[model samples]
Target: MKSKKEKGIKYFLKKLGPGNHYPKAILYLMLVFSIPATVLNIGSDIAGMGAVSNLLIPAIPSFVFSIVFTTVLTITIIKFSYQQIAGILKWLCLSVLLYIIVPFFIKVNWMDVLKHTFIPTIKFDQDYIEILVALLGTTISPYLFFWQATMEAEDVKHKIKAVVVDKQMLRDVKTDVNTGMFASNLVMFFIILTTGIVLHGNIKDISTVDQAAKALEPVVGKLSYVCFAIGVLGTGFLAIPILAGSLSYIIAETFDWKQGLDKHFGEAKGFYITIVISLAIGLVINLTGINPMKTLVYTSILYGVTAPVMIAVILHVCNNKKVMKGHTNSLLSNILGFITLIVMTVSAVMLIYFSLHH
Candidate 1:
């Protein structure tokens, strides 16, 4: 016979649905906004890279590349099994190495870079606040939270039948989640480092991802341009799937439809339809003459607004013995979680204040 605690936890888990589906609904709304932003990111990457490629090779126009890229991406997602795509994501990690390498090739003011990184400069202007919000949104995205949890659920579905996860399993989950996040931050760090050293004040504005890459040209010549351009394409290829797949997962789980990337289109029609709709909408946004970089930054603000609410719930769950059992968060974990919540809250509030006043 189960104890009252056990029964209550089971009921709570049921209500949460597959991978905390209820909370994920909020994230789905954010993803809906983010899908267009991601589409813009993809378009910008292809255009930026294609333009640079054409300057040297003069083989094909950017629109041709964009069409081919999207078609190939769609076919690959629909045709390949989940295991195959996982293999491809691993290869895409190679693109991040370019960002790390770029800094080594360029001259950097080490002292100023260290000061800005460690000391931080406070700016209160609207543009600065918006960028801050965007950075926070992109860094700790809601899509990642859903994707990570659903993925862990998928891994165990094949072998486990129990409602409870063991401490070791939870530890493994933490390790896996943190590893990806660390790599993401590392890549972001270097990209900024490269840009600051090579572009910074040199370029008044970066309207596109490719333009940001192109700014590296003067420092390392055309090779920098080519490398950065390729890097953008590779990163976009890696990110779009996550964006599209997260949207599919959230909608499917929310509606109780069968969902898995391993499943064929016929087996998971609703899931695939969700992906298609997200992609189509994103493409529409790109064709509407909206600035992709601006779109991306604005999407971050949407994420900024949504993330704290999600994080608050997550922190509650993590701290709850009902949810985590003996694996409930450690003191340090709770402290860090609160710090994150506070920081995000402050940023969100500042964003609102600045927007209203402006």
Candidate 2:
């Protein structure tokens, strides 16, 4: 029996092989930490700092149970908002969701954590605002915007809905974008809250994808490793389509081609081709043995540095009578937006100064 089990393991390993690193990592994550592992994690948490733990283990199962509950609630909120969007405005809501911090599942004393977050953090460093803004900017990424626009075009090209968009349609597009933005920010906020409480600055400066994945252990326990993989994979599922779509959109728009996803491949050859090329480039970037993470850091810095100009573009477009019409940004939105923009400026400066010093 032991020999058979060993053979089974060998067969599976051979099937996965070493070249398939990503899947292997994911498989390892599952074997090392599943429901049983999560149960063990409860024991790890039980040996916690006692009463002050993030969420009082009202019972060990409470923490586990909450995951299912929280997931349903989160999905429900997103679904309701999606339906509420006048049109594609859900996309803007999504962008806002992205801007918010990521929720780390390893939270203790949940009520208190939420309470502390509401109570403004009083770190008065000059770069504080900038850092926060930079973090927010990371959520509604530029690449995502371009990607969505292209996908919209693809949708139109297909006889999926035999209607060409009029000026009326453009307004719907803007609403969709705005709604996506909101959703994006909201999601990010939760991430920050969750991780902030769980890790409490236990680890900093993620240099590699592995480091980022490993950092989740303190928050999620033994499954920390697996949770990290799941989260990244989930994000990648959302991200890859956008990465490919955005490139296709840019190419189609610049060339005035009738490119679209809804269209059959024969109808939108250029569009589909562009998406393939974009993905291929990304694959090459990953394969060249260059640290894609280093590229991310530098790209992040670029995002920070260019934030002011991007904010100006958004503000001008959103506020313009000619563009936004009646749907122009509310005064509250503008105020908060500018505040965040100023913060981004400060952060960019700090990043530059730090880069020079280090």
- Pick the TM-score winner: 1
The TM-score values for the models, in the order shown, are 0.85, 0.57
Question: Which candidate should be chosen as best, given lDDT against the real structure?
Answer: 1
lDDT for 14 in candidate 1 is 56
Backbone clash numbers for all candidates listed: 0, 65
- Runs of candidate 2 with Cα error greater than 4 angstroms are 1-107, 110-112, 115-134, 148-182, 218-221, 292-295, 324-330, 353-358
Residues 17-125, candidate 2: write the lDDT tens digits.
2223233343333222222212222222221211112122345533343233224322332233222322343333343232132343433576776687788675645
lDDT of 1 by residue, 202-260 (tens): 88788865576578778778686677667767877887777778778877866779788
Q: What is the C-alpha local distance difference test score of each model?
A: 0.71, 0.47
RMSD per model, one decimal: 4.8, 18.1
